[model samples]
Target: MPLPSKRYVKVNVSQQFNYHTEAFNHLVKMLYPKRNTINKYDYLIDKHAFFTESQKQVISKTASSLCMLSEFYRDQDKFGNLYVTREDICNAIHILQRELDLQNRSLLLPPVLKWYAMQIQYHFGSDPFTLKQLRLQLGKSKSRVYDAVRELEHQKIVKLVGQRGHAHVFELVEHI
Candidate 1:
């Protein structure tokens, strides 16, 4: 009789899994390609002069906590695809705010203002931005975004640089 043929098992190969920490590390590397020697947070704080030292520390801690919480509660679907919804992010922010309140500390800036500052710093950086651009990015009413921008300008965090067509152009103040 011929020897029984061996059956070979086929293994399914999938794309490599991406963890939140790895994604964060990759982002840091991309943001600071040539400054590997310096701490990323410190470099970012130094680069953005609008935030006070206390605000910087608070923002950093809050961001780290949010990332941790988001990762902990990350969802996976039937296909093993990892994802986070807008609701998840909002919940995380609410939890973080409650925790801070319980600890007798509050976010240094108003929620809207803080969010606006972060959006500007991360997206627009030193580049000039218009109210229309901000409104489109934030999905807020033109008046609401204008008010927030006015508040930021009052705080000396941003300056009215010029006008672009019918919209007013603003740029983050390099120094307070």
Candidate 2:
């Protein structure tokens, strides 16, 4: 991806209609493997005449990685969140706060450390943090993650179980 533009530029009304619709559609297909509907994303694009589908999909996927997929779909099927109970929000907040406190107890972490840790925990199942798989899920650079892992190890938060190719399989150090 190109380093994103630093500033938003003024867009003309005529320009919205002139955008490469097919190109945008292709971008959508490239960006989202599971997102079938373009309606919501299209509105964001047409309104602002800024931001690409890739950026939106990355943001969406990152959040989706945190929450269950069927959840968003379920919310959509029920039509907006007119029925979300206070209990639900409270339960969610409790979980989030607990995770935050746990993370704080473990030494300083990278920007997305907690989110990535949760992702690793979810996907790892019986196993955890194979570097190749983690790298793929990370969806970004590897050397950086290696550095983060080293820091994590120094904090005694994670340890290696084995290696696949150049990537080491990892397991969290603290156990219940």
Candidate 3:
């Protein structure tokens, strides 16, 4: 006789994402070798600054793959350490390829909208932001900024949480 299946799994979203982000950041630091200086451009991801195509490809693949892995973990409610295996690297390359195709479509979007999305991701991370704040940062009019935000919403990249007067609160959509 055999006992029925008995299993238990637990996960903490905050801890899991923190560990994954830290691991990815460490890998990026090792690969890109940031300048040892205090500046605004220090943390920016500039593929053009890279010396070789291979490095850029590796970075893109690894990042997208890590994001995908985190998504999987989130879905499964499984929390664990990041281990970059050969299989993961290979799958990452494939994921990167698909993402590149998606990016091509993304490129067709207006640059302002794209910039808004990037700023939200880079500056706000998971925090909510307001349309007024975005306008102030980009030095654009309310209508112009709202247009971009609307486009992002249309593309399922951002979402509206609430609005107050001329300020509309928004947050980035994950898995984008």
Q: Top model by TM-score, which number?
A: 1
Per residue, candidate 3 scores C-alpha lDDT tens digits across 32-98 of 4531211122123342343245534544446544544453442222243233443444444443432
In model 2, where do residues sit more than 4 Å from their true spots?
1-104, 107-111
- Tens-place lDDT per residue, model 1, 43-151, is 5544655555654454454444344345446554564433534443344334334222222122335787878887887778999999888888878998898898898
Per residue, candidate 2 scores C-alpha lDDT tens digits across 1-176 of: 78977687787643542343334445544654554321233333234333345434433333333233234533433333222233333333233332223334342344566555556566664466666676787775787677766766655567778877776788876532
Model 2, residue pairs in steric clash: none
C-alpha RMSD for every candidate: 20.1, 16.6, 16.2
Considering TM-score, where higher is better, how would the candidates rank from best to worst? 1, 3, 2
lDDT of model 1 at position 93: 39
Error of 3 at 58 (Å): 31
Worst 10 residues of 1 by lDDT: 12-21
* lDDT score for candidate 2 against the true structure: 0.48
Q: Local distance difference test, per candidate?
A: 0.58, 0.48, 0.56
Say which candidate scores most in lDDT.
1
Candidate 3, clashing residue pairs? none
